[model samples]
Target: MRSRSRTYSLTFSIYSLILFNSLALHASEYLISYRYVVKDSALYNESLSISQAMKKCSGSPQIALELQTDGNKNLKKIISQNSEKFTEYIHKLGMHVEYKDTTNKAMNKSTTIMTLQTTCFTVDFNDNFAKIAPLK
Candidate 1:
């Protein structure tokens, strides 16, 4: 009985660790102000005031104006395909590179972590804020 109890406790502890790590990872999926820079593009460091940012991103005249945003994607794919553009854009702007939420579907492991800089841009960082405003 003693041996069986110890084994059970060990199994429980392992499961608990897995659950905790999973929760931690999922909680990291959202961001408040995510920067998506295009280094090689001519718009680097153009300083689109929020108004200009919104205006340049506008799609249809009916929509008034909109800002461009990119949805979450696999880390490997993003790095492979957009590595050049992303790196160049940030360098040109004298800013950091664009990053993605660690828990994004594209991000597989829980160990990968990233932070959201709330003051950098305007966006709610509440838990469900991403759902409130669709990623462009």
Candidate 2:
């Protein structure tokens, strides 16, 4: 009876390991939108000393990252890598990203607006590095 019990425990442990491994292998998808502003040189005026600027996408995707778990180093690295990948994907898809530039002579300021839309593939730092695909 003791031997049989030991066998059962071992089997359960093996299955648990398999389950954990499977979960680790799974990936999550997310849709990300990022926006930023930049100075539009073309619209800038030297006489007025205007600083031209443009806005990119509105913001980033909603992904909560805890400081305690998602350290700055890992977060920065991942974000930089994702940006490169997203740019490449956009170019490959022939996506046109338009930035609107404007200048206000009276205000002595110029603005350029830009938007970034893409699906980011990510890996969970806490989930055994499971792959996360971009959201549709």
Candidate 3:
């Protein structure tokens, strides 16, 4: 009876490991990087100037807000609901935004990395955004 119980326990552990491995294999990582570029050289210079002034006054660099999600459907929902609002806000700053989406099939879970890139200044609030700092 003891031998039978040990066999059962081993079988259960093997099954659990297989299930976890399968789930991990099916998971994906998603990255949606948004590049915010000033429409023209004049606007780029103005943005740089404003960023410098703000940083001087606040004693900290400006930081752009970021959105994060765990699944494609949720990300789509968020963008659909807020695209216009985001566009208008960025437009007001004399900039245009572009998005680049990438997926990694080897990851163990769903994840999204969103980044905002600009020119001539830096405003980073997270590690992911730090990867694409503005050009100096």
Candidate 4:
């Protein structure tokens, strides 16, 4: 009886460990968000032009636009094929890359482990605060 109980306890412990590990693995998907402010209207326009060009070149209008990176196999495939061009576009954006924590609870929870590479970009402007409005 003692040996049978010990074996059962060991099996349960192993199963629990496996379940926990699986959960941790699934939690590894990260949603990285990029935010930048273009202070100059000319620069912002230029950035928009470059962004449109990037979309044309990549044949993916979603490129440089707001994208949901997690589980986006199509976007992943596009970026993998045009990594150099994508890097160039980001570089041409001419904004300093700054890492900041997301205040969103869902985003924070999803990114707890961060094993997968996911990214998002958002260009936000406050008309009342900014001297120039974004070009339509």
Clashing residue pairs, backbone N/CA/C < 3 A, model 4 = none
> What 10-residue stretch in candidate 4 is worst by lDDT?
49-58
Candidate 1 residue lDDT tens string, 39-109? 33323332211110211121211111122224533332333355465444324434444433334566432
**lDDT: the better of candidates 1 and 4:** 4
What is the per-residue lDDT of model 2 for residues 34-88, given as tens digits with 9 covering 90 to 100?
5545564553321101111122223333433322223433443445545555445
Candidate 1: list runs displaced more than 4 Å: 31-136
* TM-score (all chains, Cα) for each model: 0.25, 0.36, 0.27, 0.28
Q: Which candidate number would show the highest lDDT if scored against the true structure? A: 2
Give per-residue CA lDDT, model 4, range 50-100, as digits (tens).
Answer: 121111111112333232233443433444455566545555544454333
lDDT of 3 by residue, 31-61 (tens): 2334433332222212111122121111222
List where candidate 4 sits over 4 angstroms from the true fold: 42-136
How badly does each model clash, as a count of residue pairs?
3, 24, 0, 0
TM-score comparison, 2 vs 3, better candidate: 2
3 or 4, which is superior by lDDT?
3
Candidate no. 1 TM-score: 0.25
What ranges in model 2 sit over 4 Å off?
27-33, 39-112, 122-136
